[model samples]
Target: MTRATVQRWAAFSDDPGGGNPAGVVLGADDLDETGMQRIAADVGYAETAFVMGSGRERGIRYFSPVAEVPFCGHATVASAIALAGELGDGPFAFDTPVGRVDIETRTDAGVRTAAFTSVEPWIEELPDATLGALLALIGLGPGDLDPRHPPRLAFAGNRHPLLVLADLGAFDSLTFDPGEARTLMDAEGWPATIIVLHEHGAGRWEARNIFPVGVIAEDPATGAAAAATGGYLRAIGAVTPPARVLIEQGRHVGRPGLLTVDIPESGGITVSGTAVPIG
Candidate 1:
């Protein structure tokens, strides 16, 4: 069996210590599912991206330390930047498990950024019982919820429960049971993370992604969650169409990251961020 080389990247931030770290394997056409999972686990990142082809169109798979996910935005961004370094910056089409994703890569001011258009997004109301359970799991009460934005299950590529808090202090003091949260997420088929948001201004939000991927209790940055947030805001009429939203995340974890989301009147949401090689 051939061993595939893995590249490490920090997504959503230019600094190596900032954004979420991801493992990218280029030319992984020979690797099997077990091999990919082993590599992901060994890399110890939230997710790892495996590319099966080396053309304008490619087959991509995302795997966490424990299991394979339908899609992973941070890994995709990391993989795109890695590919751009070798193949030159341009557009690449990915055939993910959820559906087709088109990612565009560009260089501005000597910084490379990749933007991926998510699959058609939608939102569903979170059940009353589920909402209560979620609140309890996070040590947050019903009163802490923002009245303006109701709890809902948002989906871009993966499902995430969107819970908007009324105060930023809640985020500063946020905590959750990783074991319980993982069980709930697995049972609910939410392969990504639980997104907690606090709107600081119009089209701007501070987000915390609760992701228990192996030993990692939280995700410093989650592009999928950011995309889902955009869809949730649009579906709930919280934001107008043709809007650009900013998501600030990873601060609580000490790895500050930023995500730019572009919401059109319809169709997929575009999530953009820059990734830098991690030393």
Candidate 2:
């Protein structure tokens, strides 16, 4: 069996211990699904990115410990930075299961950063019954929702139900049964339940992603969800066009990370972050 080289990286934060950790496998052409799963499990990160092919024509696959996901934002960022370190900084295109994604990497003031433009995103209203069930399962009521941002199912590369909470207190006190949440997510074909708290300042938000589908209780920094949220806000006219938003996540879980989202009037959303090697 040909061995695959796996490197650990923390995405969305320059500090290795403060961001979401991901495993990046370069030269992964020799690995199959089973091999990737095993490697990801051993790495014990939320997600692992396997890169095949070369240059801008890369084929990328994302695997959690248990299963393969169509796309992963933080892992993608980590993969890009890893590639940049070895192949030099420039634009790269990855063919993901969902669609083609374009990423660019560069270094500024000694910090390497990567920005990815997600596939076209859309929003749909969550069914009342499903929304009710989700709230009940999470021990939250409709009243806890932020009046400005209504509940909606947002999709970029994957689907997640976006719930904007009323205050930091509600967001901080969120708790749910992982088993039940996983069951619900799998049955509904949803990857995460994104709970967000909008801060007083413009373009500032705090988010938590409950990712039971990946067998992860929570994701510190989620690129896909952040992109989806930016699209959702644009669709709902909650934010003006050509806006840039900063998302703070994973702090509550002790892995603080930052995600910057740029939303245009139309088309793909851009999510940017820094990834550093976890030595």
Candidate 3:
């Protein structure tokens, strides 16, 4: 296999310390699943994107440190920003396992912000037992969860269990064993669960979710999760239809980034963020 030029970028914020960090393999035409998984783990970021080809029909895949993920939002944002830097402003298509995503960056005025239309986003209410088990395994109780937003499985490019909390303080005092959650989620064919930190003060939130027993830090920003959360809010009627909202993530980790989610009345959610090269 030829060497692939892997570039790292911090997504959501113009500052490196303001968002989630991901690795982007600009050239990955010949890499396989094993190679991608290895690369993702090696990068050690939450997620990494591998561009397998070129043009509007390029093949793209995302991987987490522990396993191959169906889709990853932060990595996609990073990859889009990186590509925009080299290829200039234009639309790019990524054929992911979930579906094809049309990506474009805004650069007419200044640094471009990348936006991806999720692959047919939808929501599925989780079972009561499953929700209870998840809450118990994660050391959170029913009260810790947000009653306004029920637990549901939301899909953007991929699927994630959306667990909403009312405030940042509740989110701040939370913990979940990744290994245990992974085992449960894997059995259900889901990669991981997302903890949606909700704060109404500024339509901004900081998110933190733990896996079973591996990576210990919080995910500064999660576009996929954000997309799904937006969908869930619409499904539960928490947010009015056609709501477009902005989410601020990674503040607690000191790498805060912004996430913009658009919930349409008739289609998939759109997630967006700005990505900058990590110096």
Candidate 4:
């Protein structure tokens, strides 16, 4: 079997050390699912993106260390930047498992950034039993929940349970059992991550994504969760139309990443970030 060339990139930050790392395998037409899984496991990132075809449009698939995921945000950003490096910065469309995601790449001052529009987003109420179990797993109680934003399951490309924390201290001091969370998440069909957020200021939020199945306990920057947050805000009427929200994440993990989320009056949410090569 021909070895697939893998490119390592850190997404959501121009600084390689500050963003979430992802593996991008361009020209992966020869690699099957088993090969992709093996490569993803070897790369050891939260997720890796495999691309087939060429030019502005390509077929993309995402895989975690253990299994294939429906969609992934940071990996998509990394893949877009990877393509831009070879094909020149411009618009690119990906035919993902969820749907078509359109991305635009621009280079300014020698730093390339990418912005992607997520699929149609929606929200649903989190069942009480599941909420209690999740809270226990994450070491949080119902009292710690922020009343401003109710608990909900937000969907952009993947399903993420959204929990807003009332106290910034509690949000920052979060600790959880990764093994337990992995079982729960897998059982509930939540292969992505659970998003715990704190609204520190108006239009500014601090997020923590509890990703149990991966090697890391928490993801520094989560594009899918950020997009889901935009949907949660819209579904609950937390923000006015044409609002811009800023999400600061990964500080707890020591690799901080800033994700820019744009919420329009209706339709898909747009997430923008910069990626850099990782050694």
How far out, in Å, is residue 25 in model 4?
Answer: 0.1
For each predicted model, how many residue pairs clash, with residues at least 3 apart or on different chains? 0, 0, 11, 0
lDDT score at residue 80, model 2, on the 0-100 scale? 93
TM per prediction: 0.98, 0.97, 0.91, 0.98
Off by over 4 Å in 3: 211-217
**Deviation of model 3 at 137, angstroms:** 3.0
Better of 2 and 3 by TM-score: 2
Q: Higher-TM-score candidate among 1 and 2?
A: 1
For 193-229, candidate 2 gives per-residue lDDT tens digits of 4545556467789888887534468888999999999
Off by over 4 Å in 4: none
Better of 1 and 2 by lDDT: 1
Note the residue pairs that clash in candidate 2: none
lDDT of 4 by residue, 80-177 (tens): 99999899999999999999999999999988899999999999999999999989987889999999899999999999999999999999888998
Candidate 1 per-residue lDDT, tens place, 1-279, comes to 677999999999999999999999999999999999999999999999999887778999999999999999999999988889989999998999999999999999999999999999999989998898899989999999999999999999998999999988887797899999988888888888999999999768999999998889999999999989999999999988999999999998899999999999999999999999998
Which runs of model 2 end up more than 4 angstroms from their true locations? 192-195, 213-215
For residues 1-279, what per-residue lDDT tens digits would candidate 3 score against the true structure? 788778989888888767888899977988888998888888888888998776655788888888888888888888887888878877988888888888888784687899988877778888999788877875778887777777787776666777777756767766666667677877877774455566565455556644331463457788888877777777778777777888877766677778888888867788887888887
